[model samples]
Structures are given as structure tokens and as C-alpha cells.
Target: MAPATISTPRYLLDQAKRKLTPTPNTIPGMGAVDKRLQEKEWDQFVFAEPPAGSDLKPIMGDSGVPIIGHMIEIFRRGPDYILERYRREGPVYYAESPALSSVLALGPDATQAVFSNRNKDYSQRAWDPVIGPFFEGGLMLLDFEEHMFHRRIMQEAFTRTRLAGYVPHVDSVATKVLANDWVANDPRFLFFPSIKELTLDIASEVFMGHPAGTDKELVTTVNHAFTTTTRAGNAIVRKPVPPLKWWRGIQARKTLENYFLSRIDEKRRSESTDMFSVLCHSADEDGQTFTDAQIVSHMIFLMMAAHDTSTSTMTTMAYHLAANPEWQDRLREESERIGDGPLDIDSLDKLENYDLVINESLRMMTPLPFNFRQAIRDTDLLGYFIPAGTNVVTWPSINHRLPELWTDPEKFDPERFAEPRSEHKKHRYAFAPFGGGAHKCIGMVFGQLEIKTVMHRLLRQYRLELPRPGYQPRYDYGGMPVPIDGMPIVLRPLR
Candidate 1:
């Protein structure tokens, strides 16, 4: 499917041409506005001027096509579409699609401005339209004081002591899943789906404290529900009707709620190692604890976040390692030094080479690429005037590959994250795979440990390579950027 022709209606072309006629004002460091911005209609966002008295420049750019906007091009070209626009329109500009219509904020500067949210102008309500129906009560959906309240309670479960406890369970679950499901010497092993299932199993055991293989059918149902609900974020028709993607998502949300609600009472009554029990028994400084409803809501969101991002990260890392066998061998040697045994938190930390590989992979893909926020009050981003009630999106994946930020941004170089180079340190928000500021991912440490442990086991047991001489993964940007082909690879037994 081709992107809608930008040249149409003589009037639009004329107006676009007029806007390009070298205006007096230009963004600092940007000099004159590029003629590229005039390629699309500026009036689509209805920004006739900046607010009454504000000196901020009127937000500029066009809505692609008519109804669907840039949705087709976005799914077709992925991050490249946004990166091209960023170059043409500069940092702050308008973007529209079936899923969302907002100002696209590119680069670390924009990332810091919104995420820092000093004025409290940005609210999490922007996500209500996208993920609110399904993950309504999830932590990311909450804002300001309410968000902080819930986060304070949630913090108890992710403390260093608690994270250390989870490592053994993650390692054990990964070892068992790899032993049973993966066939050594298999020429066409499906890495994406296989890792997805493995991560889901890990979440079940480590998060819900479910024993391996217990309630097998129910776990499978929950897995399907998560996949459906997450995919619904990109549904063209956002309403629930019949068997459409949006409707399926609504049903899946109900399924997830039911699953979590049914298990809450049991978790609350017992003291256990899993996060569910931890949240149930945990209390804030004032001895406050989550109510049953709060526990259920948090669990559903946490469960989805935990497994989904981990699955994506591990899959991307596996693909990169398979493609670059030298890095895989180098990592294997690092893991071999630790040898075969239960990997503790300290041991996991010792794999410095693995750390660089993981950081580089996250920079390349970043499971959660876009963050959404609505302007509660009028706000200015990099001199662009954004009125109240506008949805603002920050694309971190674009910032990751900005040429100014990293050397040879397109190439895969793990060493950039290592010693003398340390490119990721160029900016505070430069390498935010887990996001930044208050709403950053709560389960980040747990997620990283989970990935490292699983990859360590896989490296010990198998040598990874692509099924063909030159295989590149085609990702479906519709959701969390998954490999559409399931990422097949050859799994050669090492020991």
C-alpha cells in the first residue's frame, strides 16, 4: 500500500508554497524553516497563530492523506517516517494517524522537556484513548498525586532485596522452558514466539508465584488475552463492536480482570515470594496497603508490561546476536567464565559484555518507542506553542538513532556503550529504553535480570544463527514492534 500522494488539490499546494516563502522567524540553531514543511498543509491542526499573547511559534505540519493520516506510512516505514519528518519540520511538529493525532517530539531535548514535566502541564490522560480501555487502572494511566500514591505502594515490590529474590526463580524458569521446548540443532527454531512463551512463563512463576505448569490451560488463555489487548492499541476502529480488533481487546480486558480478580484473595491471604503476594502484604510508610480492587488492577497491568517488554527485548537481542555471530561468541565466552550453576544477582551483574549487548539492542529497538501525554494546560516545547488539550508524543527510538548522538547510528556497535566511547552518556535522556522521570518503568531491574538470565542459559546450551545466509527481521509496528516472521534461527547445541 502506497502513502497518499502529498501533491493534490491546487489550493493546498499553493498554501504550502506560500508557507515556504522564507519567514523571518526560525527555530534557534535551525536557521530558516526548511521548504519541506510546506509540502503538507499547516492548517490541518487549526493553529492560525500561537495563543493570544504567547510568543511561541504556532505548531506546524500536516495531517497525511485525509482520514487515516500517516497510519499506512508509519506501519510501512516505521521510525524512519518520523525521523524524516523531524529532519524536515524540526523537533516539534504535528502528526496524525488512526491510533493518535499529536505533536511528535523528537530527540533527547524533547524527551527531557515532557518527561520532566516541571509545570505539571502534561497529563497521562493521553493514553486513555489508546490503552485506557484495556489497561485503565495500570500505573502509567494514573497521574500526579494519584500516580505517586500508587507508585509509592508499588515500590515495595521492586526494592533491591525483592529484585534479588526474583533472580533465582527467573533463572530456573528460563532453564526449564529452554530444556523442554527448544530442540538443539533445530534449523528453524522460532525465537520470537519461543521467547514470548518463555517470558510469559517467567512472569507467571516470578510475578504470580504460580508453580511451573500449574493451571497450564489458564496461563495459555491469559497469554492470548495479553496479546489481543496490546494489539488493540493500533485498531483503526477504536470502538468495541462484534469480532473486530477493538471488540476483541475489550473482551480480553475482561478476561484479564477476571483472571486477576479470582486470584487476589488467595494471594492476599498468603505470604509468598511472587510480586502478587508482595503487593498484597506490602504497605506504605503510613501503613497503607492496596485494596483488593487496586491489587487486581495493578496486577493485570504489571503482568502485561513485564512479559511483553521482556519478550520484545530478548527477541531483538537474539536477532542481533544471530546476525552478528562474533558478538554472540564473545558473549558466550563471558557466560562460560561464570559456568553452569544457579545465576545469582551478583553473578548476573558480572557479565559486562552481556550488558553492552543488551544496551545496544535496547537502543536499536526500545520496546516502548512512543510515550503519550496530553497538555492539561498550555505548554511550550522547544519554542513551539502547544495549546491546552493537545496530545504530545515523544518517540525515544528516533532519539536513539540520531546521528548527532551516536557514531554510525545505523550500525550495530555494542562497544559504543563500553568504556572509552560511552556514547549513551552524551545526554541524560539519551538512552532511555525504560523511559525517564516519574512514570519510568517500575519493573526495569526485574526485566533486565530476566533477559540476562534467559540469554545466559541459551548461550550455554546453544549457538544462535539465522536460518538463511542473510535474514533481516520485518517488524509489525502495529503494536510493540514484534518480528512479523517469528524470527526463525538455527539452534546448535554446544554442550
Candidate 2:
């Protein structure tokens, strides 16, 4: 499975190159762009026109080895290597992908510019050509007016009343899933696979109103399709060349879509309280309801978004809790305080300690380390000109570790987030586990409730410990992070 080639048309590349080479022209806000006088500032903007005769340091250490750079190290090493290089080589760093050029940006100012104010300049279109087969017409890939319009319809699924309604569903689903027949004494039982299954079940029951035992095959198909599509998106060549991963991904997506479309007619006819039903009955301001195709596409998108992200966060929290007994003890104590009452929305609010632990886990091991946005126009970012069509990545993994914002940044300290300390308050985007701005994750509240509920039940019944001391989970770089060897833990029943 070769890495996916990210291609930019020659005309677009040429346009970006032109924008990079700024000329001495009078611009309103930026004053006159004097080429000779502002050469230093100009050099910051242009990668091709670096200060004459200066050697470009490798964007990532030893990642230049064939296939290893794109295929392996980037995912395996996580964000530390990139952040280390950024610190050594200044804010904006460049790397070659064999397919296309990539630029990685770090620091609070750069992150804010990319994610907050200048998001319009970036396109999720690059992701579209690959992910489109699976998540077609999803809000993450939509742009401009279409994005906003669809977002409004999707927003209806996450209202306060709707979220409150989901609390019990989350509680019940978590309770049932964690109470599976798996042995409590076994340390080799993989938490990632278990949690993945649990989240998919949760999505089926909570989001789609499917009964606990129903839709097993459909859920399995969707999960396989999502995993395959994400892998295909990262492939260097995506043709259905026999036996290749991309071919399998394409087949998986087709199968999943067929299943979803098949169910849409039935779902549309039977009015219900699920989010899927809401989406089916939902109409835009123009009285437009999603077509069958749109319905299937959006349903797949919602399920993938809901399941994978929550699973990742929960897995990370589990790993951290297993590693730090003190934190686990604190969480258990907090869960005890909340008692064994139903973990409804009101009960979730009382588990403030659970919130801190989850927030801290997200900050330490962010599910999506970097967000990609393509520049739409020539934009000045803190004096650096980011040309249109340039790929701009805001590394949240790096920002989460910034020393200026966090005390003992590398340590797992949930207390730092508690009151009186209030460290994360220093920067609004400091803890962007759910992201920020209008594009923030819509299911964030639901995700938190799900984690707290699951944790509350699990902690009350069992004392979880890792297989070995100082065990760190390895991530599968294909899509969202997953435990490479399955996070092994022993769940000792509380006596």
C-alpha cells in the first residue's frame, strides 16, 4: 500500500508560485510591497524563493527515507518530530511528498490564523477526491454557502433539547456495552477493538434508533467501509489495481452505500426519534429535504464522525488512567460521588472531575493531530504571505504541548484544568480537542457525555490497570489514531 499522491494542477501551482513572488505594488492594508526593501519578509512567504544559496533543512528528521516519510514515520512518531523540527527551523516548515509539496505550521498565532480567521482560504477539497466516495457531500468537505446551509440542517441534530434526549441513550448503551461477557482478569483483551465495537453499537442505538441487537451486519459494513476509505485516501495511487488496499476501500464504500440507501426508504417511512429520523424529516429554510443519496451520505458521515472520534478519546483516556493510578483513583472517587443513579444530562453536569480528565486526555493526545486547509487566496498570516492553493496545516498536537500555555506540559496533569489554576484559559484555542469556530465539532457535547457515562459505570465496577508499567499505545496512522497492538488492560472487579 503506497502512500496517496496529493496532486495540484500545474495552473494552480503556477498561480501559487506567482503569489509567492510578491512585486512592488501598492496594497491597501499591507502598505507597498517593495520587493527589494521587503525581501526578508518576502522570503518568509515564498518557499521556492528562499534566501539565495541557503540549504533547506529537512522538515522532518530522517523522514526522507523512501516510503518511510509519508507511509510510516509521520504516523508512528506522532507530532513530536514535526514540532521539534519546527522549533529548530522556525514556524513554517516544508516537506516533499513525492506527490506534492507540504507545509507544516506551528505556534498559537499560526494556528489561530489557519483555523479561525483564515479558514475560508483553505479547502477540504483535497480530502474530497479521496473521501468523497464514502463521505460524499459531508459538511467537512463542503465549502462557502453550501457548507453553511448543510451545517444548519446538521445543527438541528445537536440542539440542547436533542442533546438532553441523547443522555439516557448514551448511559444505557455504555452500561450495556461495558457489561459484556469479556473476562475482567485478562490483560490481553484489546481496548481499542472493544471500544470501536462499543461506539459503533452506540451510534446504531443512540443516533439511528436501532434496537441494541439490530443492524449488526450493517454496522460492521459501515465500520469496514470507513476504515478502508480512510486508508484509500492516504494511498499514493488510488486505482483499483487488484489486491491493492484502495481497491478494497472502493468496494467497501460501495457496499456500505448500498446498505445505507436500502435502509433509507424504510427509515423515511417510519417516523422515529433518532437523529437519522430528524435528518430525514428535516427541511431547510427553502423547504428542501435531503434526497435519498444525500440522506445515505450524511448518515454515513455522521456515524463515522460520532464513533471514531469518541472511541479514540475514550481509548486514550483509558490508557492514561491505566498508567496513572492516582488519576484513576480520583476519577473513581468522583464517579462514586455521583452515585449509581441514572447518568442523565443532569447527572453528567455533576461529573465535573470526569470532564477535567477527558479534557486533559484530549489535550495530551489529540485524536487529530493536525488539520489541513488549502489557502483560497493570497493571505498575510502574521506578516507571512500564504499564497492561494497552498496547503496550510495547523498542528494542534504542537500547540497542546506549548510550554508558555501549560505547566509541566508533557505530564498527564488533569488538575491543571481545574479551577484556581485555570491554565487553559490563557488561550481560547489551547485545548481544541473539538476544534473551534463555526466548524467546531457538532457532536462534542454528546461525545463528552458518552465518555463520562461509560467511565462512570466502568470505574464503579472495576479497577483498570495497564498490562505493563509505562506502557504507551501505538497509533495506526491510516486515519484517526488507533492502538497498534490493542491497548491491553486488566479490569479487576471492585470488591
Candidate 3:
């Protein structure tokens, strides 16, 4: 079969060229390339056909009968279904739905090769059809040099000094959001929505430099857009008909673009110190910067990353802490040691127990279970030959739960991360909550600081427990692993 033709939007092509030119003070060993071949290669490689006899795996049930794998079932059953397949069929496996040509990788070495060593080979295009309209020039969709260049420009927004400056902003947002009366003593309060609200507030204050609780409309619009786009990407039917999720996603993208563009001029004129301002004033080696559209698209991507991933991480941590009260007590005791005060950069760093809790939560409930990469060229992974056009996946969710790497693989134990054990050191990619290598999450430190700060304040102010005994969090296997129902918790004032 002939490969699918994907035309680059004129604006994205222009932005790519702008990033190619060298800028002042380009790092000595940056290894910058000023060419379009990489991007061209990506377009060709993503849509190429897989070799004959590369049969996709079938869904197996308890009785061992082959069942049709649907997106709905995958979203509902999540890692369980995939893990079951891995147990039955070795390391590499495949699954197919009408919409996706899916691949699943099950061990540390396999995951490392896909996410770390061979990331350049994968295409973000699978996510692009939905996210591209909203985040046209965002780094996630760009490959190789194009990805590096934009990442360099955005790195200015996350400097240590800038992150330190965000401390008060994060603290203030957490205090205001967690102090709500609705959260008090309510055992059935849905956590996903609540945490989503909190993260949106944090993003406004810390990323955009807006005041907490403001920009509600813009936040709602972008959040809806992200949800709709993600759903469309995983939808089994790929029709362009109106009223479908894909249609709604496209409309949402336009709404976000318009909203972001309207705010750019005001933000630029004020010369604000937030990420939006940094992107506006940032220049490459040639003193070039993103145009208006690029700025809006980038903001959309940054806002989604900042809000959704942080909120999901916080929710997962809450689930595990609520499930095990003894651990919660330990964390609260640690918080008491640090005192019940607003966390600054220095104080946030001191919460070692909280850090372990967060790490364990991430291991069990990885926000992105599998990282996908297309092979840029033919490559070898653990003696298996992977052709240039094939899709490669790294399963962090599966690897994190391996019996060989973790003791009591399914239990909620934070001490495994403490000194002397440090079991995650078994392999380089054994604990990649934020991935590894060149495309490792640049905001990893910032994300960790944000979650730790929130958990510290919550522990000091409230005693939380799960609504019902033996509550198990269900997974949504769409993009990130989100709790199917909002994680419910009852909060009691600590005082």
C-alpha cells in the first residue's frame, strides 16, 4: 500500500525554518542541524506498511478465547488487559482496533530502547491529527532538530531562578483551592474534577503569571479541547462527520487559538515574567522568535501539559494514600516535622517521605503507560529486527510492575525508593515516570516540586481517607492512565 500523504501547514513549515537558523550563543556542543530531511523522513516513515507476517495480537480472556479488542474495553480494563497479554506472549506484542495499529512492549530493556535510544524513530502524528490543530508548532509533534530547537527556547521558562519564583504562586494556589468547604469531611467528593481545578489555578498563576481563580473560561475551553482531542485520537471510527468527537475537537482547537491569540498582545505589552512572556521575548541564534500563531499553539500545548499531567499525578497519589492509612499517617508525621506553614523552595526539598509517596504513586499509575516512537531507520532491539517504518512502544506501566524489578509488585510501598533498597536502580529505565534520554520531560523538576508542595499543604491541613473499604482505582487507557471515577476521599481537619 502507498503511504498516506500528510501536507505540512504553511505556518508550521515557516516556523520550522525559523528554528533551523543558528542563534547567538548556541551551545558549543548543541549538534544543531539546518536541514529538512529529518522532518521529511518522519512523514514518510510513519505511514509506511509493516512487513508481512507481523500479525497483531488478539485480545485473550480468562477462558483463553480470542476476543475482539475495542477501545472501550481497553479504556476500561487498562493495564490489566495489556499485562495479561504480556504474561502470555513474551516481551513484544501487538493489538489492533479499527482505528489504531497498536504495539505493546513489556520489559525494561525494550522500553528503554523505544523511549530513550530510539525516540527519533517515532511519530507524534498519531497524536497530531487531533492535537496538531490546537498545538500546531508545539515541541511534542516536532522530531529531531526541530524538537531540540524549540525545547531550547522553552528551557528559558524553567530556569532554577524562575522555578524558585514560582514557589509562592504554587503555595498560594494550593492553599486557596484546598481550603474549600466542599472538600471538608466529604467522603464521596470526586477527586479528579477537584484536582483538575486546582491544577488549572496553579497553571494560571505559575505558568501564565495570572492571578489564581482567574481565566476560568479560557481554562474550561482548553480543558474541553484536550479531552475531546484525546477521545477523537482513540476513536474507532475515523469519520469527518459533524457531531462526532473529532469534529468537536477541531472546533475546540479553533476556540483555544482565538482565545490565546487575543491575550498575547496584552501579555507582550506588559512584559510579564510568566512562560507566555518568555516565549514572546525569546529569540533563537538568529534573534528569531515564534510568530503569533506559533505562540498561541505553544501556549495551548504548555497549558495542557501543565494542568492535565499534574492533576492526574496528584489524583493517583491521593488514591494510594487514601487506600493505605498507615502510609498516610507516616506522611502526615513527616509533614508535622516540617511544620504547618507555606512551602518555599527550600522547605519543599525537605519532604523526603512525600517524595517517596509521589514516586510510588507514579510507578503504579504512570500517567503515560506506553511511549510510542517510529523507527527513523531500521534498528535492532534485543536481537529482534525492527524495520524503519514499524511503530515501537515502551511500556513503563508493565516494566514498573515486573516481579524481577519490584518486590510485592502490586502493593503500595514507598520505602522501596528509600536508601539501602533503591530497587529502582535495577535498570536505567526501571523507574521512568517522566521518561529518559533526549526527549525526557524538561519540566520534570518543576512537576515534582509542584506535586510535593501540594501534598505537604494537604497533609498539614487535612486527614484524608478513602470513601469505602477496599476501594480500587480503575484505569482509563486512552492517553494517560486516569482514574475512571474521580478518586473519592473524606477529609477531616487535622487541627
* Alpha carbon lDDT of each predicted model: 0.82, 0.70, 0.69
| lDDT of each residue in 34-132, candidate 3, tens digit only | 122122211111212234464432211121111323344456556665675577656765444444444456688777766666436555554444345
Off by over 4 Å in 3: 1-73, 118-120, 129-134
Question: TM-scores, in order shown?
Answer: 0.91, 0.85, 0.83
Which residue pairs in model 2 clash with each other? 3-235, 3-236, 4-234, 4-235, 4-236, 5-236, 121-376, 122-374, 123-374
Clashes of 3: 8
Worst 10 residues of 3 by lDDT: 37-46
Best candidate per TM-score, number?
A: 1
> For model 1, what is the alpha-carbon lDDT of residue 234?
89
Which lDDT tens digits does candidate 1 get at residues 91-178?
8877655567678888899989999998898888888878888998799989999899999999999998999999999999989988
Ranking by TM-score: 1, 2, 3
Q: List the residue pairs that clash in candidate 1.
A: none
- Name model 1 segments beyond 4 Å from true: 1-48
What range of 10 consecutive residues in model 1 has the weakest lDDT sum? 1-10
Best by lDDT: 1
Q: Once model 3 is optimally superposed onto the true structure by TM-score, how far is the C-alpha of residue 224 displaced, in angstroms? A: 2.9
